[model samples]
Target: MIEERNPTNTWIVDDDSIYVYGLKKLISIKGINTNLSHFINGQEGINALKKANENQQLPDIILLDINMPVMDGWEFMNEFAKLKPQLGKNITVYIVTPSLDLNDIHRAKSIPEVAEYIFKPVKISQLTEIFSQTQYQTNERIRQYGT
Candidate 1:
């Protein structure tokens, strides 16, 4: 039997409603229990993150979209850079975009907070792997420090 993974607080920051719903469903279908939150744009996402941080309820992972109407992913990242230190917790962020532009990929890679740059229509296995890796990392940290 597969080991049940720990539930994660996951945030989806994208302008596309259909993509958001589909992604959420895929996450659930993979049996990766998640307390999910959605934001239609980067500004909204940043605001939510700030509130969550204030309550000490920041998400474990954030799926970020590059292109949006207001405050695109890059803009959000710029703001996030300023807010990150105040957050007091390490939150992993993945850049999810359909763009195959090398510049975009390079830019994302340059950012330290971006854990991975995923192409459009993220696969179930990819998400599972991410969860598994995160779980393993968490377990290791706990084992080492008893946190």
Candidate 2:
């Protein structure tokens, strides 16, 4: 019997529509099973996260961009930190940006919630590794928590 895998709930919080479109296409081409939600900026992402938290339907992974209009990634991280303790499940956040600033990289590294910092124009290999890790972690969590 083949074991069925659940789709990963994923979010892309970014202002660039073109980038989002490309990323979605890449994900589809890779045959990754993901239920993706897109937010134009950090504020929208935060609001959606709040609603998701209330409904206990939080995303499993977040690909966040650094620069946005309403709220930047740093600001969003601040808000996320405050709201995290109330969340029912763990969410892995990746900093996906074009910025090559060392400060930004260091900042992301400093944050405990950030899993990794990825450069823009994300590669297929990186996506594969990330989803594979996500699946492994999800399976491990299920084995341990039965949830």
Candidate 3:
């Protein structure tokens, strides 16, 4: 078993059990110590994010799965946008999907909050890349957007 951390987060939104297992496995294998949180759908993720926002501690990262049962990643982003300046600098979202569809990739590329569109069966390398990208991007955003 992996040791859980406090402050609620590096998060994931996915309905599939196997993917969740694999993701958790990756996090553990990579020695990621952040609080690992998950939600079955985007709505739940949004609710948690909202609560976190109100509490002044949104997640460090959000791994969003595209094809979910209710309220998909796009919807989550839309909902998040309406939250009245709740999310701070560290809250970044990444689209994690098994699909190789070009349209999906294109769409992911278009979204600003979406830091990157990562392929599923997500590897250690991808995780490392994501970490680097997110760190750089977040810092740039904080600089440009101010906090």
Off by over 4 Å in 1: 1-5, 140-147
Predictions in order: lDDT: 0.87, 0.93, 0.77
List, residue by residue over 1-147, the lDDT tens digit for candidate 3. Answer: 642222325788988889898878877787754567889999999888878877866777889999888798888878866763756535778899998999999988987778778888887888877665655665565567765
Q: Which whole-number lDDT from 0 to 100 does residue 125 have in model 2?
A: 96
Taking the tens digit of each residue's C-alpha lDDT, what string does model 2 give over 1-147? 654677888999999999999989998998998889999999999999999998988999999999999899999999999999999889999999999999999999999999999999898999989998898788788767877
Residue pairs that clash (backbone atoms under 3 angstroms), model 2: none
Our model 3 lands, by Cα RMSD against the true structure, at: 5.5
Worst 10 residues of 1 by lDDT: 1-10
> Residue 122 of candidate 2: its Cα lDDT?
91
Ten-residue segment with the worst summed lDDT in candidate 2? 1-10
Clashes of each: 0, 0, 0
Q: TM-score of the candidate numbered 3?
A: 0.79
Best by lDDT: 2
Q: Could you give candidate 1's per-residue lDDT for residues 1-147 as a string of tens digits?
A: 664455667889999999999987887777776788999999999999899888988887889999998899999999999999999567899999999999999999999989999998888788888877767766566567765
Each prediction's TM-score against the native?
A: 0.89, 0.95, 0.79
What TM-score does candidate 1 reach? 0.89
Q: Candidate 2: where are CA atoms >4 Å away?
A: none
- The superposed Cα distance between candidate 3 and the true structure at residue 137, in angstroms, equals 9.1
Order of quality (TM-score)? 2, 1, 3
